[model samples]
Target: MQYQAVVRKFGPAAEAVEIERAALPVLRRDQVRVRLLARSINPSDIITISGAYAGRTTLPFIPGFEAFGVVEACGEDVYGLAPGTRVLPVRGAGGWQEYKHTDPSWCLRVPDGLSDFEAATSYVNPMTAWLMLHKKIGLRPGMRIAVNAAASSIGSILIGLANAVGVEPVAIVRSEESRARLSGSLEAVIVDRADSDLATGLAGRHGLDAVLDCVGGAHASILAAALKPGGHFVHYGLLSGQSIPPSFWSSHPDIAFSFFHLREWVHSEAMENVQRAYAEVAAQIAAKIIATEVREVFPLEKIRLALQSTLPFRTGGKVLLA
Candidate 1:
């Protein structure tokens, strides 16, 4: 009984998503058939399903970005990959499906050291955190950086990865509760969401060399001003359902501004470079330098409940579909 969580129309994610029974995809000459063991529900997936990227997104598609599975079958030309070999269909089109067919090139062999849950979430946030720091910003030891929505899985990963390399990362969170969740964990700044004085907060602590922001709109606006001259400001997510003012680019002429979309990097980068990143991230995960915490796991049939638990950054961990 093959199953997939499909979105036929754009709307709110929890309501628009539907589980449909379908036949397994036929293996192509250069492909392998993998039975997906686990998938993760990310904010990016939620918005994409709701038509956030409607311009590029094709409807009537399965909505999932990360998952891990085991090779169950191979195409006529496929070789070496044996049945029961655990693997991650890295960046597959429809990870929500029970069976995913892909060219062997897209699959990364999952190490036995990683559990199914960990492997299922090995990409996306981890990759985003890695590339943004290492590739995009060229983060070096002792460089000062700040990450907002600092309690998210990605934020936590950024903190750990930065610390591992001797970079100092400041956490900027909203509200006292969010700050409390991270109290004493690191240097944190709590600001009012409506109208934060993040710049002022940074002044006392010393301005940042770079700022990595996921919360857009007002929070991003505030963080933008806090960057040192010639500093980089990278915006990746817009959880606030708003955009930073276009005028900010002109207002901060001395600051470098950019946005990061993992898909763009993966699609354009050479496979060897991308695989090198995979190896590094996997090694860190294996060593417990960074981790993706699972708040709960729901079977494919329970997607609605699982989605409802997509708690705002910080407190609740990632919701997984297993």
Candidate 2:
């Protein structure tokens, strides 16, 4: 049997080649066959294709991290999950396809009321936001935090999460355009880079207790300066194509800096721990406290277009492949 997929060939400048009939494998005893409904194209997906994920990406692989699907079939050992159950497959790289064969343990049941797009993108951004807020910083109500790339999917999730818990979220945007787009919907202090320095803007209002920085480079330095003494700065993404400067670390000797990656957390934690976190995030999604907005949905064959739409900037929502 065969299925359609977006295959990334080995080497640089390699486009995501579309394969109409890639060979499909038979299910193993602990596995289930999922008919994928929708999947999101995230920044990590692009980084994996560019061969820049610290050599973690292997060649000739299908490029996707999380996706929503229906259980079409299950192995003999796969109990509880029956056919037609909507599921979100985590911990795999072949989500940009029509079907996926993965361990039943890696799939989470999509909570009711979530659209295919929302369910598809539930894992990566939401899990990152939740863990960073709760586990890393232990952010409390009334605490102030600054988030770079505040218009991004994960940044928006952070804002919503902070708001739900009564934390004051200061969203630092790169331009007035981004500020305008976010101000109407998000309940936070939106600071446009064109109008104010990040440190100056943040200092005038309140001292930052923590910083969630997805955009690295000069923006990270500015965010670092804004943090109060003994505050933490968590760096998760390198959207600016530059890492944190060494001088900033030397200058801000009192601030704590940490790097976060979801893969590392998943690999190190027990299965039960991972499942519990997912369950909590799922509940939040169902409650509408954590949500994913879909900017667009393209069919599996149109993955090229979908990937293009999410390039190098925040689109205010996720771009999905269905």
Candidate 3:
């Protein structure tokens, strides 16, 4: 049997991606075959397709980090997971397809009550936000943290997590339009980049304990400057297409700056630990303490259109393929 998928040829153009059909490989003894129901387009997907991560990504690859699916078949050696179980595949690639054959160890059972949209888009942004808050920074209640890209899915989740624990979240957005979209709807102090300088607006005002920054380049410097003395500055995204300047670190010696990637964290942990983390995140999603707001859902055939939608500065929410 065969399934359709979005394939990325070796190149940097949107045209590099094409829809094609391929035979489904047989499952290995420790593997399971999944019928993918939903997947989301993330910034990392765009970056990988654009050749930014070319050194790491092989050509003619499928470019998706996470997806939700149902167990269609399991190898004889596979246990615990059975046919018809709702699961999310937590792998490095090959998610933009109708079916996936992967190790059962990489699959996490989706918690009951999460919609396909919630389960499909669950791993990357939510886990990044949750781990960064709980494991990396050890954010505590009553502490104030400033988060850039406040309207993004991860940013929204960070706000929710911070609020749930009594932490004060200050959302930094690029424009008033973004500020308006996020204000009142989320519990946080919203700052518009166009109206005021981020450092001046946040530094002396809030006594910020940390800056959870997804926007790199110049914005990262501003966010770093906004951090209170001895605060942590965590950079997780390079949406600006530029890396943080090395000079910023020397200039801000009192602040600690670190880069975060979810893959590294997952790789360092045992499989059982990974599964536990997924279950914890699923519980948060079920409780609505952390959630994804999808901007659009497109069929797998319209992958080009879906990829193009993410090119805009801010489309307000996640774009999913179903």
Please give, for residues 95-117, the per-residue lDDT of candidate 2 as tens digits: 87888999887777886677777
For candidate 2, the per-residue lDDT at 45 reads 72
lDDT tens digits, residue span 1-322, model 3: 5445555465543577887878777678898999999998887777787787779887778878888999999999999999999998887888888988888888988977899999988899999999988887888977778888887778889888888887757777776677766632333554645525665666565456888988787656677776679888888987667788888878789887788999999888998998899888999999989878888888987887887776653737888889
Show the colliding residue pairs in model 2. none
Runs of candidate 1 exceeding 4 Å displacement: 183-185, 311-314
What is candidate 1's lDDT per residue for 136-246, written digit by digit as tens? Answer: 889897688888887777878888888888775788777777666552235556564555367666766646788998878855656667778888999898877788878
Cα-based lDDT for every prediction = 0.81, 0.78, 0.80
Q: Write down the worst ten-residue block by lDDT for model 1.
A: 181-190
Which should have the higher TM-score, number 2 or number 3? 3
What lDDT does candidate 2 reach at residue 274? Answer: 88
